[model samples]
Target: MAGFIEKKALKKFSPGEIICLEGDAGNSMFIIKSGQVEVYNTVDRREIRLAKLGPGEIFGEMSLIDGRPRSATVRAITDVECVEITRAMFDKILAGSPNWLGVFMNVLVERLRIADKKQRVTDSVEIGKKTVYLISLMLEKEEKTTGIIYKQSWKKLVEDISFLLDIPPSQVSGILSKLIFTPLAESEFNYKDGKTFIVKDWERFLKFTRFCKERYLKNITKGIIEEFEVKSEKEVKFLKFINEILKEQARANDIEMEYMNSKCSEILNEDISKYEKVISELVKSGILKKAVRDDGGKYILVDLELFDIKFQKYVDIELFENILKKFEN
Candidate 1:
């Protein structure tokens, strides 16, 4: 089986490369031939490291046996060579293995499912806090060569997290979206390459991550669902509309305040007064600001750096982009 896999289905990965992602449909398993791989899962925007597999260990067998989505993400910690074994190979191997190997595979799959379920129950806020700490660590490591990291760098960062924490890239992206809106990090989205820089403040950022982790853990242990005030639905809609306007039109800063208010009223099909209140709330939150122009006055959506810490929490990128396109036309 090993010889067959090596001859017909060898695969290679560079250091920091993703092998497979959690939740992805998979039909094959990988047997590590050289180097190392890490497995991890992301829950609630936080990555939980599962295990590190060195030479001769097998992964993706659960998917191959059950025909289910991958339970966790796997990434190469170093340059890795793998012998790929497909479902066809599994069928052939099962026939050859005395009934014992098949029994072991079934037992392993059941144990993995139980573990995955427990990991999934972790609080999202706790996971988010963990993600922030991981990102800060990555930024600290990269600070030597380049202080500024871009969007493309995020792909590499995701791979790094998968390798280090054993989490999937899709979950890393989700965690990143949350982190962007936090005070612990700052991002500018309008750069030429669409790269968002991670503001480095290692000490304070890590402190916050630790604080959040402890607080969330306490709440969960006490069976408390902590509650806090949140924006009204109308206010959320208004902010989203403004975010769309700023994103779709580069000249949003020059648009007159009155014009924006009128457009908001038109788009939302609500009274102008409602928009006025929403705008006032946005201004209070520092998401929007008044600017002086030679002719008169206008409102400008503040730069991404000044974005409210909670703004991205309410943002739906797909919905905002679709609305922005319609508004653009």
Candidate 2:
């Protein structure tokens, strides 16, 4: 069976060699014409055996179908001879046998089903981002409806948030419905396009999340990696926002440099510099300005207005200001 493979396609593997690992791009299928290969998965730092394959058995057949990750690790158990069928060959075979289209579809569908399990985790995070984004949009719509900001329709709002969050319109709608239930709920509008839920009191949501963030700021900083678990981008942005507020509050209170650091540590239960660095970068970028305190504080005075301008580019101004107020005490 191994000899059935074209000489050009026949590949050999040495014992103990890793033929492939999980999450690698699938490109080729292998038919073990000789020798043996072991399959395993790593979980909790332990190797769990899947199975072993010997002569005439095929591995990577699924890879040929879906072009997804290998899903498991395979290592050569002994010097081996295997026939490889690449994605190109798989397509060529399909072209010649359109009658097998249903077979290919079934294989691809099964691969997708397995892949969806991995995607559920990804989708949950995506849904979380969508939740944040929809809330942000709801704030804008509320501000406009109340004449605080420019007016925009719910359809347009959904479209904009969907594009920014990189999620489907349907997912955005589902999340928006949940968001509308809170004091954050503004107005509900149904149009030919779709339904939109707006936030009525932006301040309520802002203050609530801000209070939540501040009350948990200590725990948030300590267990942040576990709680309110945010992505690196959001974490960085949030840290920067908090740091700028701390700097401003320090300056306004005329707190000494040593005192501000101590105060920050007390409030967030963490050193201030982690956030200080982020503010320093913004200052360097001219997005934020810095001033020195005559009180002889080692920390730089971060300009809140400058910080607000920069942050407004990434998040809502009202939301930013509310989140920053958490550090005021």
lDDT of 2 by residue, 1-329 (tens): 23445576788999999988877988998888889999987754556577999998988766657666787889999999888888877777677777778576767769676785656554544454435545554555454645433233666666777677665666555555544544445444455535445544555555445434443444446644232333356345554645565656763622345665676676667675767665566657664454465664454444556655454434543443343332222
Model 1, runs deviating above 4 Å: 42-49, 98-104, 122-329
At residue 110, candidate 2 shows an lDDT of: 90
Deviation from truth (RMSD, Å), model 2: 17.3
* Local error of candidate 2 at residue 69 (angstroms): 0.9
User: Each candidate's TM vs. the true structure?
Assistant: 0.36, 0.33
Q: 311 in model 2: Cα distance from truth in Å?
A: 56
Worst 10 residues of 2 by lDDT: 320-329
Q: Write the per-residue lDDT of candidate 1 for residues 1-329, one digit (tens) a residue.
A: 55666689999999989999999998999989899999987766876778999998999988998788998999999999998888887788799878988878878888888876655544444455566567766666663434443223666667777666555676667677656665545565554546454655555455555545554566667542222223577766776676677677763454566777678777877665666776677778676776877776755656565554445544533232232222211
Clashes of each: 3, 4
